[model samples]
Target: MTETFVHPRAEYIDTRQPPPPPQPPPPGLAPPTSPPYITSGTEECESRWEAGAAMTEWEEKEVEEEEEEEEEEEEENS
Candidate 1:
């Protein structure tokens, strides 16, 4: 009797019910819309990010070239 009491309980797994459907928003308030200004701002941000990324890539290549030149100079001196 004690072993059966301690065994897994199927009733616990069967008890859960699906959630009810969501209620609609109230009638008076209109659904939110993205304003033109907001979209324009987003586009500006995207362009700026692209430009910044390109600049960073160019800078990295420049740095690598400088390092290579320095290494060549050291080798020539040695």
Candidate 2:
């Protein structure tokens, strides 16, 4: 019995590619824009955070008072 072996085409397996030269994009193309309004994913994330929770005018006043008291105590100790 004789065995006949056939080889595959070379083009199908060839992996050599020239390193693509760096090129800038054409200037006329506009950048993609995101949706103007909040989406469902954004809404869920926002709900998880305290809505607009930040140091308000009253909270700032309390912090200022505490700091001043500490400064006065330091002066008295010296």
Candidate 3:
């Protein structure tokens, strides 16, 4: 004949109940409307490059104008 024994302090968990739902954020805080950052596309890169080139041309023109004005002032003072 064989004999079986069980532990007296073992506990059993109930699996019938569902887990609790997630909590919502407090007042005055809202979710983001858009992503934190964006990955530039080919069109966007081209546009940015064109803008930079235009700005460089504008700055060169401004420098030339300032140099011409300085030369005029020097001629007037001579």
Candidate 4:
């Protein structure tokens, strides 16, 4: 007995198509006209930098206070 096998065509196996273009947002739910970062000026940037520096200073003071408390506790125990 002899058997014959037929291969499937490429079009039948792979029928992939290009993805559709992105759709615009609805009129009622459109994105903001101007982003916050784009509107921010040098003054805002400077204030943010100053705030970050102040936070670091505050953290250092907290660590120093904690160290002082630990030292006092050690002295009391000794």
Candidate 5:
């Protein structure tokens, strides 16, 4: 008659206790949300006058497509 088996013991972590003091935001949590674009000054002078009237209507449609490609190269060189 011979039976012997017991091995389970390892837990004494007390690392000089001092790391637990930051946990207080769980009571219907709600306290941090406010900053969604809030610019002023007449909305920055109407977004710089609508970006200078969209860059002066894109430089007047590139000077009316370079004056209709110089009047279609002067009517295909007459």
Candidate 6:
């Protein structure tokens, strides 16, 4: 390696869904009795491909508009 310094460059990313609607806390939710996030066996993979998912311009615009309308409605009600 010519230079030993490591650098990172970031890029902007957009999602298809309008960050899923937040759910209100349940009056009384039960806790799971078992442990979670324990993967028995798995393989290292090219996770980057997921971010490359395709989204048409129309779909993106539709979601953006829907989100905006929802925000406007909430603001008016509040």
TM-score of each: 0.30, 0.32, 0.31, 0.31, 0.18, 0.32
For model 1, how does the per-residue alpha-carbon lDDT over 1-78 read when each residue is reduced to its tens digit? 355565556556666788989777689967656564665543555555677744356655765787999999999999
* Candidate 3 whole-model C-alpha lDDT, 0 to 1: 0.64
* lDDT of all predictions: 0.67, 0.65, 0.64, 0.67, 0.65, 0.57
lDDT value, residue 21 of candidate 2:
98
Instruction: Estimate the overall C-alpha local distance difference test score of candidate 2.
Output: 0.65
What is candidate 4's lDDT per residue for 1-78, written digit by digit as tens? 888665666336556787999788888986656556746444554555677744456655765787999999999999
Q: What are the C-alpha RMSDs, in order, of all predicted structures?
A: 14.6, 15.6, 17.5, 14.6, 17.2, 21.9
Off by over 4 Å in 2: 1-53
By lDDT: ranked, best first: 4, 1, 5, 2, 3, 6
Off by over 4 Å in 6: 1-53
> What is candidate 2's lDDT per residue for 1-78, written digit by digit as tens?
998676667338658998999776578966534465656543444444456646557656766787999999999999
lDDT of 6 by residue, 14-53 (tens): 5467787867667796654335553431111122224575
Residues 1-78 of candidate 5: C-alpha lDDT, one tens digit per residue: 887654444455567978899887788978545345655434544455677744356555765787899999999999
Of the candidates numbered 3 and 5, which has the greater lDDT value?
A: 5
Point out where model 1 deviates above 4 Å.
1-55
lDDT of 5: 0.65
Q: Weakest 10 consecutive residues, lDDT, candidate 2?
A: 40-49
In candidate 4 the C-alpha lDDT for residue 77 amounts to 100
- What TM-score, to 2 decimals, does candidate 1 have? 0.30
Better of 1 and 5 by TM-score: 1
